[model samples]
Target: MSRVINTLDVALVAAAVIAATSLLSNDYYLRIIFMMCVYYLCAVGMNVLVGYAGQKSLGQAGLFAAGAYAVALLTTKTEISPWWALVLAAVIAGLCGVLIALPSLRVKGPYLAMVTLAFGIVVEKLVGEWTEVFGGAQGIYGIRPISWNEQPLTTQQWVWFAVVLCAVAHVLIRNLLHGRFGRALLSLQADEIASSSVGVRVYRAKVIAFVVAAVTCGIAGALVAQQNQYINSDFITFHLSIFILLLVLFGGAGSMYGPLVGAIVLTAIDAALARWPSAQHFLYGFLLLFALYAMPGGVTGALQTCFKRKPKKQRLSTGETPKTTRIGPVASGDLLVVEGVTKAYGGVKPAQNVSFCLQRGHIHALIGPNGAGKSTMINMLTGVVAPTSGSIKFLGQEIADKPAHEICRMGMGRTFQNLRLFADLSVLDNVMLGHHTRMRNGFVSSLLGLPGALKQEAITQARALELLELVGLSHLCEHPAGSLSYGLQRRVELARALATEPQLLLLDEPAAGLNPQETAELGQLLLRIGQCGVSILMVEHHMDLVMSVSDHVIVLDYGTKIAEGKPVEVQANPRVIEAYLGVDDEPDASEIHATA
Candidate 1:
């Protein structure tokens, strides 16, 4: 499917270029095409940040201005040629992007948008006021165009270069988004907590995405400046940023061909409305409203909806023999050790002085009533929540202060009590994301679609399919994870977590929404996984499953450990019975038997 789309896109771009250059004689229409090329570049870059990473940036014009000014100033003030200026433009803009991304790490949604919007306004005002370097509101004129054979290039020649640049940028962006980096971005978009739990460095990936977007915008800005031979403060504004954003949203933010198609259509609309300048804004507002109402997924998404494919009759292959699937070698003792761990929120402690050791190749169950701190202890071990006091050692190393992703990379994988599957992504994609840390490819390798990255991707895909088969959802591997039943989603989440191939698996209510049969199957699956040398630490309410599977059990009540023993021993303890049912009330025989 993806190959077909890529071929179609290449054919469309080639056909459009040939038709526009040969059929259109009017310079006005030709100029519009040139501007569309520039907008295509901006929209493609913005799509990466907005569509792929799911970060909102309303200040792309600021980055755009930085690029334009870089080229304009360097060529005018120094000995640098336009070519050198263009390169510097991208670097400068990418640096500016880092400035915004740094602050964005602390904010999201509208707050982040406001930050970028303020940046765009500031850039515009600074350029308008700074007369010495920027030429103030008057701006710079007579900037040299790109040259070939030591001869200054014309606008027509510049337009061809712009088209070529857009094509190259599109291919690179597509490759980057389809490979490991793209998968990480999609995971970040779905759920940052889940993404981190799978060993993805969420903030770092976002920053890299913004930098890529900024470089592309910078390239577009440079192209526009050279083509016009003039650049002024009014050209790059907050309004321009909004226009670019509209193009991305209206064209389908995440689709490979959406941005370019949107650029062509919107640019033409703007040109047609040039005679009635007042109506342009009104029409744009109307089009945005219509797009939201009629085509929520944008044009490309709508087209996909119109041409959706039928489900394939396929099943996951399952001929391989099971073997020890090891993440890394562990010390010959407890896989995890927690001592005197405490967590507090404003004098209220949800977990206090919790201590437990999970031996290697054993299933250790942590059980407690609601709000008994089982979840908190699990969070602390996984590094999702920090301990206010005490220590946590995993694989013979102290990881009390490590980040969640670092802990994950250190051979810990966990599932959420509330399902955290990437709702918009496919079952296979969700599982493939588990191997993110295992992948060794760099951004350039991913963008170039190198043999190494492609090979790694294939291996991950086959492994993910095997995981889906293990969980008995192999037939639904291509379906969206969110569309599955709650039980199925849980299984998918487990498959995704297992993709990490952790030495220790942390299952938080793994059988939460499952029926008796499903729960039994899950128990059998866990035992199978444990046989592969993986240790399990589970927090479960299903006493039958816990008692049947756990080698050891720790009981918690009111934020502290009350009993620790084998399941039967813990069940027989008076304190455990008192914690579940008050001393005045006798424990039910069936309930006691359930724990045995």
Candidate 2:
């Protein structure tokens, strides 16, 4: 139903634009409309990078020039059709995006912005200096415009063409951003570590976002070059890149309609300020600062907030039975094996020669005092921290050196000791992101909104809801995960981990901040998960909860395992008791057990 409304809204806007264009005969107004369409194309893609993926890019002009220059050179130097040159230009720009994105892998925030800014400066200088290929300041002329029925389109026709392109771009982007891919980008922006733990390939996702932004900006530039039948270094400027970014920021960076709103309003402002050429830059700078400080969400976000309706209450229901199939590669022996695992930080050893075996379908607990390396073991197992020396295997696959996302894909799921929820996302969206690796839809299918992709999205949402029910958070599914109570956020994180459907679940201090009642409930939840054939390795400090729920207990002291046995047996070990209670002349075993 919401999808239908969104489609209708877009259709109405498109129809309105076409009607307005038909009535306007002035060339100036028509050109303004055309430029709006071009800028909108740029902003729509930019939003994916800056807003959703949280990548800071200030070099969009370089990508735009890539397309503009590609079209210019291809049409003048070769026998390529204007239409074919347009497509090739977009491809060239996407390649440029890949180049700029390489810097993002090593830097972030202001450093990334500087790298992109340098890229724009370099492109600007190259076009100005390279007269042989780019034609330099004199510019290239006689570029052929796109035509219908073998004749070049008229001025009004160009306006119509750009308007149609804008509509198409909006719809395609909306489709692409409404599913798992969208959620993955949002998750990537929220927390890369948490995103990877849920099986999102962090670097790949970043590159995809950069490419998306570049392709659209490239298309915009190609359209401009073709329509004007000219191109030059003057067309590519640092100011243009800033203007493109301003469109996303002032219109609402994350909102679907943000680009359209931004393009229309800012383009009009640009035209009005044309009379005061010197003041245009000043006003634009002011607007950027204002948007960053006073209107971070932009005009669309502010409008939505004003008219936002209360979310309907959701009722809890008995969750459907979870799938019974074991969620990992078939293996005949123990589910996991760790031998001689050691992790050292300079002179400090957080983990040393740790060896353990987790049998199929049992709950094992790792308990230790502060600095005893319980959490470090969890990190090593999940591939977040590489072991200095070790062998770690899960379901017969060596995973000690794998990337975090790859380890997650191999049927290992975990919760962080510190809550890592995608705070701005709803509880349901958070869980649905965990299914990203399992979904079969490809990028093209998602972008085009194919039936299979839509079907998978629906199925994933239903399954996510079921997980919320299982965690007693069904009624709060629509609430932001960050807005929930501390205990509720923990549950949301658990449900998200469960969405990965792991055969081996590694939980790091799952009950860290929960009250006694919540801790007890978490114990029951762990037991229930174990009954479903999922083996558990939990790092916990709550002795009572650990003793009650864990099938085997391992005690660590000063980064080394000191005891391993049944909970009762570990409780009776003098080393375990001394570690917990400290060395004393007469330490009571029962007192140590109670204190632990």
Candidate 3:
């Protein structure tokens, strides 16, 4: 029923846009509508880059120019039909986008913007100066118009075609962004580090976004080439790129239909202000500033908020059949080995020659006072930080210098001490990312909602739901991770880590902010996890919980391992006591035992 309503809404919108064209039959008004369609198409592409991938590209005009010239050069110099030339223009521009994205994506923020800016200027100058290839500053002239049935299309016919093309672009963008690939892009935008930890290849996602945006802008340029029936270097410039970006931003970067709304409103405003030419630029800048200040989420976001729909009540379900899937190779001995692992920043060592072994299907705890490098050791083991010396092995394979995502794919999952959840994503989505490594479907399959991808997605979702239930957070699965309380967020993070179905779980400071009651609950949770044949290694400061759950314990002080044994033995070790409480007031075995 909801899908039916959404489909009806879309149909109504498309019909309205098409109907507007008929209502305004004047050639001038129709021409304005055509320009809006072109801008809307380009804006949608910009939205993919700026809104989805969180990339700032100032080279959209270069892509637009490439498309326009491809059309112009092909139609005039060769005998290619205008339609074929437009298709070629999109291909040429998309390739150029790939070139720019490869290098630009390596850097981020202002550096990336500068790279794109330079590319746009270079393309503009090339078109202006390359006399033979691009017809120099004058550009190509007498470019043939796009035609149907071997006859040049009239203005009205061309306007309808542009509208249809814009509609198609909208459908494609909406479909592409309504799946797993879209969530991955949003995750990339929210937090690159967290996204990578969940097995997202940040570089590849960004490049794909750049390519998509470039193609759309290129197509828009081709449409413009058809409309003008001529081309010039002056039309494609850095200012045009800025205008395109502004359109996406003002309309709402992340919202579907935001580009359309932004394009129409901005173009109409600019056209209206044309009579007052002197103040037009100032008014435009002012309006942009005002919109940003008033609605950080953009026009679409503001409208959504004003007309926000009440989320349906989601019931929490605790009962489910447990799943049994081994995360790594079945082994009978120790699951992990760390030998002479040393991590140093300059001359200071946070972890010095740390040696430990995690027996399979057991709970091992690392406990130490502040500055004991417990978190650092966890980082080294999980591939978040590289060990300066010595070897670390997991599942009988050395994994000292591997990247975080690779290690995760190899069956090591971990939660951060500082809580690195995707704040903008729902709790369920955050957990879903942990299953990304296990997913087999391609992006194309996900976008098209193929049966295989849908089946896998459903399985992943059910598994995530089970994990959330295990963590006692099934009720908050749809909530934004950031909105949860600190203690609750910790549970959500744990659920996400478990979603990877890890053979070894590395939990850092899981009890940091929990109350005594919550701490007790966490201890039971860990015990249940261990019963499932998953090995547990945790860095914690909560002594009572650690003593209650840990089968074996390692004590660290000043980056050095002082003791390793049963929890009771570690508690009574003289060196561990002295390191924790100070040499002047060391506790005896009996006193330590009593305290425990």
The TM-score values for the models, in the order shown, are: 0.95, 0.97, 0.92
Instruction: Please give the lDDT score at residue 394 for candidate 3.
Output: 85
Name the better of 1 and 3 by TM-score.
Answer: 1
Deviation of model 3 at 314, angstroms: 3.4
User: What does candidate 3's lDDT look like per residue over 121-163, in tens digits?
Assistant: 9998998888788877677888888888879987778777887
Q: Is candidate 1 or candidate 2 better by lDDT?
A: 2
Count of clashes in candidate 2: 0
Whole-model lDDT, model 1: 0.85
Please give the CA lDDT of all the candidate structures: 0.85, 0.89, 0.83
For candidate 2, the lDDT comes to: 0.89
Judging by TM-score, tell me the better candidate of 1 and 2.
Answer: 2
Candidate 1, 73-147: lDDT as tens digits: 888778888888899999999999999899876898889889888888988888888878788778898787679
Give the number of the best model, judged by lDDT.
Answer: 2
> Lowest-lDDT window of 10 residues in candidate 3?
321-330
CA deviation > 4 Å runs, candidate 2? 1-5, 316-332, 584-586
Off by over 4 Å in 3: 1-12, 19-24, 275-278, 316-331, 584-586, 589-596
The deviation in Å at residue 582 for candidate 3 is 2.2
